[model samples]
Structures are given as structure tokens and as C-alpha cells.
Target: MQNMSLRLRGLWADRSGLAAVEFAMIFPIMVAMYFGVVEYSSAISVDRKATQVARTLADLTSQSQTIADADLMSFGQAAKAIMTPYPGQPLVSYVTQVYIDSSTGAARVQWSKELVIDGAGNVTISGTAPHTQGTTVTLPSTLSVAKGTFVVWSEISYKYTPAVGYLVSKTGMTFRDVAYTRPRLVLCVTYPTAGFSNCATPL
Candidate 1:
């Protein structure tokens, strides 16, 4: 009976399977942390890309000699240029819904759209003003061309894929960094040389 008891004790003291137990205990935590880092990194990248896209759109619209209908097409093409690396399809789709705030009182072209999927995996868009429910966007208002320069509002969004899908899945875990820039020409104006009577119209 004593020999049997000694054998049971030796069996209980054996270290076999210890490493597997430790690995099992630590593996999930390590995986969670890894995914967290990836999510954070993706978020940072998206933020930087969002800024680039906004600046590109703003620069293109502002530097152009004119912001007319034909020129707007160029603006779309310009958007495609700025949003590199990421597929242009989503961004291009959002561009169609841009709106330039031409309200008589306000000198601004308000353009806005969503680029990423919500927590629910739904495509969404937002704007300074209401917009049509579609991919690309545009807004129209009375152009007070003479009084003040027009404000150009450009917005873009994109959803990130889960590089580490094993850990977490939620909406707020992802975000879109929307950006805004006023046209550089906002302070300038184009009008007739002689106020009114002599020229076509006052600036």
C-alpha cells in the first residue's frame, strides 16, 4: 500500500502538460492584445489617410480657376487621385453626393459623405447639410459670388478590414476621421472693374 501511495504522489508531481497549461492560459490574452494593436494601428492609418484625402479635395477645388459643373467632374477625378492605396470605388461613390453651400448668407460649399461601415456593417454618410441618399454627393445654393468667397467642404470616409478578426468585433472600435478645409480663395472675389454702371456688375 505504501508503494502504491508513493507512485500516486510521483504521478501528481510530474511536470508534463505544465507548458501546455501555461500556453493555454496566456494564448488568448496575447491574441487579444495583438488584435488591439492592429486595430489601433489601422485607426491611426485611416486618420492620416482621411486628412490626405481632405487636403487633396480641398486643394483641387480651391486652386482650380473655376468651380463649375464641368470642373466638378475634375474634382471627382482629383478625389480618386488623393485617396491612394485604398480602393477608389468607395471614395468615388461618395464624391457624387458632395454639396457646395451656396446659401445667400453663407459663403461655403458644404460637401460631406461617409466612407466606412457602421458597427452594424451598414454604409453611412454625413454632411453639413442634408443630402440625397446615394454614393457621390453635391449641394446647390444661391451663389453670392460677389459678397464673399465660397467655403468648400470636402469629406471622405472608409471602413477598415479586420487584420485580426479573431478577437473583437464592434462598431465604435472603428471610426471615420472627417476633415474640413475652407477654400484658399475664400477671401478673394471676381467682379467688374468699375463697381457697377460701366462694367457688367459690381463684385
Candidate 2:
């Protein structure tokens, strides 16, 4: 009985198990923190990609003077090409709003669209409408368009999904990006014409 009692006391007094117990307690927290970091970086990457796609589309529009009505379809295709690797099904959609100055007869255009990111990585295009309000949404009539001319505003949208789903909230996990660009120059060219060739000619 005495030997058993001594053994029990020794076991109760030993400090060897403290380190293992502490590590077990903190391991989950460390893992969670690591995952949080991954999630943050993933979000940042997606944002940059979204921005790049928008900028690329805008630049493409600005560089051309022979943009025809049908070229809008090409723009949508290019937007989708740029926004790859996202987990959600990705899509490209655009809206075009035209504004004309009553006094100067100059024209201005603006665009705004939603880029929806789904749970899996796939892309599609939707949304082509006019804006009815706000200041920034409206551009100057004399910014570049010719007098009494119509301005075309296009809004492009793409859907993106995060890589680290476990880190971010499952609800509203997708992302959206929109971009707009007005015609820099007006060329008297119609669709399916050689205008694109001349417009695309390097300056």
C-alpha cells in the first residue's frame, strides 16, 4: 500500500508531461494562423488579377480607332482569357452608357459591370446596360468624342473564386471586377471591315 501511494505521489508531481500538453493546446491556433495567412494572400492575388483584366481591356479599347459595334464581343472574349485560375466559374459581361453634351454637342461614355466569382473556376459574360445616376459615372462630353456623336460605354464583369475556401466565409466568397473605357478616336469604319486592320496598325 505504501509503495502504491508513493508511486501515485511521484506521478502527480512529475512535470515531464507539461511541454506536450502545452504544444497540443497551441498547435491548432498555429495551424489556423497559417491558414489565415494563406487566405489573405489568395484574396490579394485575386484582386490583382481582377484589376489586370480590367486594365487590359481598357487599354485595348483605347488603342483602337476602328472599333466596330461587333468588336465588343472580342473585348468580352479577351476579358475572360485574362481572368484565369479562379476557383469559381468565371464570366465576362459589359454595359455601355452614352451621354451627349447639349451645349457643345460633344459626346462622353461610361461603363460599369459586376464581375461575379463562383465556387468553381469557370467564366461567362453578362450585363450591358445604361447608368442612370452618380457623378463619376458620368464623363465629360468633350473629353474626346466628336460633336453630335454617340459615345459607347462598356462595363465588363468576371467571377472569381478563392483558393483557400476554408479560411474565408463560404457565404459571398466569390469576387467581382468591373472596368470602363470610352472611345479615344472616332474612325468612319463599320464592322467586318478592314478598319480593324488599319486601327490595329502600330503607332
Candidate 3:
């Protein structure tokens, strides 16, 4: 009985594998924390990139007095370039000119362009403006402008997927942002391809 008691005491006092056991218990928690932080940081970065894409599109278009189809295409390409190191396939952007009616204060679409990026990074710009000319568009209340003036509107959307599915969503999350700017050199930006010579031709 004494011998058995001594063996039991020795086993209780032994500390040889304690460190390994503690590590085994804590390693998973540490890894989870690390991945959670990584996923959150990546998502935030992507969201900022999305906002930048929107701002870039609007800023570039507003700086030009007149916009051509080729120019619009170049703007889309610039947006895609801004999203480098991140997948551009899940991005879609639009640039539109909104004109506020002098008499009624209503906002209408002057010219709109749609830019789509495919899964292979192939860019496609609509041959014709997507939104109908003269169609009414709702502007944010904060984006008020003088009557008969014009504002350039840019909208961007991106789907962000985390590197590891364990921490963030496994499928994908969508981030959207919009920016508005007035034309830099002209009262309204015109698109000749859409047939309106100037901003005063009834639309």
C-alpha cells in the first residue's frame, strides 16, 4: 500500500509534459484570434479601395468639359487599376451627369455610362447610355446644387472575399460607395454620342 501511495504522489508531482498540454489547449485560440484580425483588416482595406474607385471616377469625369466614349472607357480602366493586388472581377462602376432643372429644381440624367468587369478582368462599357436621357434621378439631400447646374455622379460596387473562409464570410461580401462632383470647366459635361449638343437642348 505504501509503494502504491508513493507512485501516486510521484505521478501527481510530475510536471514533464505540462507545457505541451498547455500549448495544445491555447494554440487554437491564438490562431483564431490572429485570423480574425487578418480578415477584419483585409475587409476594411477593400472597403477603402472601393470608396477610392468611386471618387476617382467622379473626379476624372468632372475635370473634363466634354466626355467621349473612349474617355469613359479610360476612366473605367483607371478604376480597375486602382484596385490592383485585389481582384477586379467583382467590381462594377457607373458615371453619370445629373442636371438640375432651372424651373423645377428636379434632377435629371444628362448622360450615363456603365462599366462592367468580368471574371477574367475583361472590361465592358455599354455602347449606349444605360439610363434614359431626361430620366429623373434622386440625389442625396446633402448634394444640393443651384438650379440649372450639373453634377457628376459616380457609383462603385465590389465583392470582397476573405483569404480564409474561417474568419469572415465564406461566400463573398459586397461593398458599395458613391461620389458626386461638379463639372470643373463647364456648366454640364456633354456626351456627343448621345446626340445632345449642349446642356440647353431640352435635356
Candidate 4:
């Protein structure tokens, strides 16, 4: 019985396998934390890219006095290119010209364009504007503009999926951003192809 007790004490004091045992207990948690951080960082990067996409669309459109269908398509392509190093097929972007009423200070859509890239990398520009003409759109309070002026509005959305299902949502997540800018050279950017003679008139 004394020998057995001595062996038991010796085993309790043994430190040779302590590291391995501790490591075995903490390995899974360390791996989980590592994957979680990677997924979180990736999500943040994609979110920033989404914001850049929106800004690019709005900035490019705002700089133009007159925009045609081809110009809008080019802008879409440029916006898609900004997502390089990452799959751009899951991105959706929109460009809209909003006119604020001079008398009532109400904001309404003059013309809108949508760009969509499918999973197969096929690009599509909507034939019909998603936002109806003359429909009211709420602008952010911080985006103050002159009552009679126009603001170029851009929106971007991206669907991001984690490479590993261990940390983030396995199904996926969507990141969206919106940007607004006043027309650079004109009161409003006109969509001539859409049959708008002036910025005040909605097509």
C-alpha cells in the first residue's frame, strides 16, 4: 500500500507530460480563435471594398454632366474591377440621380441604373430602372444639398462567405454601403438615353 501511495505521489508530481496535456486542452480553442480572427478580418476587408465600390460609382457618375447607357456600363465595370483579388460576381451596384425640389425641398429620383454580376460572372444592366421615376428617396441628414441641386447616389452590396465554417456564418453575410455626391460640372447628371432633356424633368 505504501509503495502504491509513493507511485501515486510521483505521478502527481510528474511534469514531463504537463505541457502536452495543457496543449491538448488548449489546441482546439487556439485553432478556433485563429479561424475566428481570420474570418473577421476577411469580412472587414470585404466591407471596406463594398464602401469603395459605392464611392467609385457615385464619384464617377457625379463627375459627368451627361451619362449614356455605355458610360453607365463602363462605370459598372470599373466598380467591379475595384474588387480585384476577390470574387466580384457577388456584387450588386446602383447609381441614381436624385433631384431635390426647389420649392418643397423634397428629393425624388430622376433616373436610376442598376448593375448586377451573376455567379457565372455575367454582367447585366437592368433595362428598366428599379426605382421608379419621381419616387421620393430619403437622403442622409449629413448629405445636405441645395434645394434645387442634384445628388448622385450610389449603393453597393456584396455577399461574402467564409472559407471555413468554423467561425463566421456558414451560409454567408451581406455587406452594403451607400454614397452621395453632388454633380461636379452640372446641376444634375442627365441620362440622355433615358429621354431626359433636363435635370428638373424626370424620365
Would you estimate the TM-scores of all the predictions?
0.54, 0.58, 0.93, 0.93
Q: For model 3, how does the per-residue alpha-carbon lDDT over 6-114 read when each residue is reduced to its tens digit?
A: 9999999999999999999999999999999989988999999999999999999999978787888788888889899898888889888888888999888888888
- Computed on alpha carbons, the lDDT of every model, listed in order, comes to 0.46, 0.51, 0.87, 0.85
lDDT of 2 by residue, 1-203 (tens): 99999999999999998999999999999988998898878777777776776666665665565454446556655665665555324554444434454455533332333334344433333343344322224454445554444344444444444455667875434455555455566531222332123322211
**lDDT accuracy of residue 137 in candidate 3:** 88
Clashes of 4: 0
Query: Where does candidate 4 clash, by residue pair?
Result: none
- Of 1 and 3, the candidate ranking higher by TM-score: 3
Q: Give per-residue lDDT, candidate 3, residue 192.
A: 90
Candidate 4 per-residue lDDT over residues 1-203, each given as its tens digit: 99999999999998998899999999999999999999999888889989999999999999998988888888878877888777887888888888888888888888888899877666679887867778898888887788888888999989999899687889889999999998889877888777565865643
Worst 10 residues of 2 by lDDT: 194-203
- Angstrom error at residue 106, model 1: 3.5
